[model samples]
Target: MIHPTVVSMVAAIRRRANEYMLRQLSDLGLEGLGPSHAGILGRLFQNGDMAMAEIAAAIRRDKSTVTTLVRKLEALGYVSRRKAPGDARKTLISLTPKGRALRPAYERISRELTELALEGFSSEERKALMGLLGRVRANLSLR
Candidate 1:
């Protein structure tokens, strides 16, 4: 039997993970939001209010994509955008009460994902796997 390529394996894993998260989100009554929106919301949920550019960077998305995601989040009553306190050119994105309320579900989803991904792995093995994946990511990030 032919072994699967690393890229294919990783892509498949990501697709499955995103699908699982989307299903969980739908079950929680958040029907319209996708992984991109989750990325932005997750960042704001963890870091509080952040500038648009910062959100884009943190989510590893382009500014235009982040703009669209932020708009969707705003429409869903999960986030709000305002001009930065000192910089009119910069906009800050923050979570609303509705968004904050999703924290418990998000935390549950995160824990579930972690447990699913690391199933049957010992602590040391999981750490090593993460370290190896980090190196792989770093390798691909080189210019």
Candidate 2:
């Protein structure tokens, strides 16, 4: 059973974690991106191509915001958008080679940031924290 206090504390911690992570990313030359944009990029990097609406749903954002972000990425040459061959009204989005090239750098910076955040945590503690985070995500996803 989850206590209300525990839930509240967890939520606060999550916010703090987000702030800290974003600050670290800022140090790594990550700029001009809000949380939503970062979320979209991460999703695209992990899941490959997707429809605009699908990307919006996956990122828990609205379609208009996703469209703007997609346009920005497209202009930056990081992504490309095309009408799906079978469906003219539906657009498919995919990361370009330049975007794929960013994966290694992003991964490295993220790993370094995570390591810094967990500097004092033991290996077992880090594993336990990761497992708990995964379970929390799974629980939220089911809803």
Best by lDDT: 1
Question: Candidate 1 residues 1-143, lDDT tens each?
Answer: 99998889999999999999999888988888887677887898889999999998998999999998889889989899999888899999989999899888888998999899899999999999999999989988994
lDDT values, one for every candidate = 0.90, 0.80
In model 1, what is the error at residue 34, expressed in angstroms? Answer: 1.7
**TM-scores for every predicted model:** 0.95, 0.66
Query: Using alpha carbons, what is the TM-score of model 2?
Result: 0.66
Candidate 1 accuracy as TM-score: 0.95
Q: How many backbone clashes does every candidate have?
A: 0, 0
| Residue 136 displacement (Å), model 1 | 0.6
lDDT of 2 at 110: 65
The runs of at least 3 residues in candidate 2 whose Cα sits more than 4 Å from the true structure, single-residue gaps closed, are 1-35, 131-143
lDDT over C-alpha atoms for residue 69 of model 2: 91
Model 2 clashing residue pairs (backbone): none
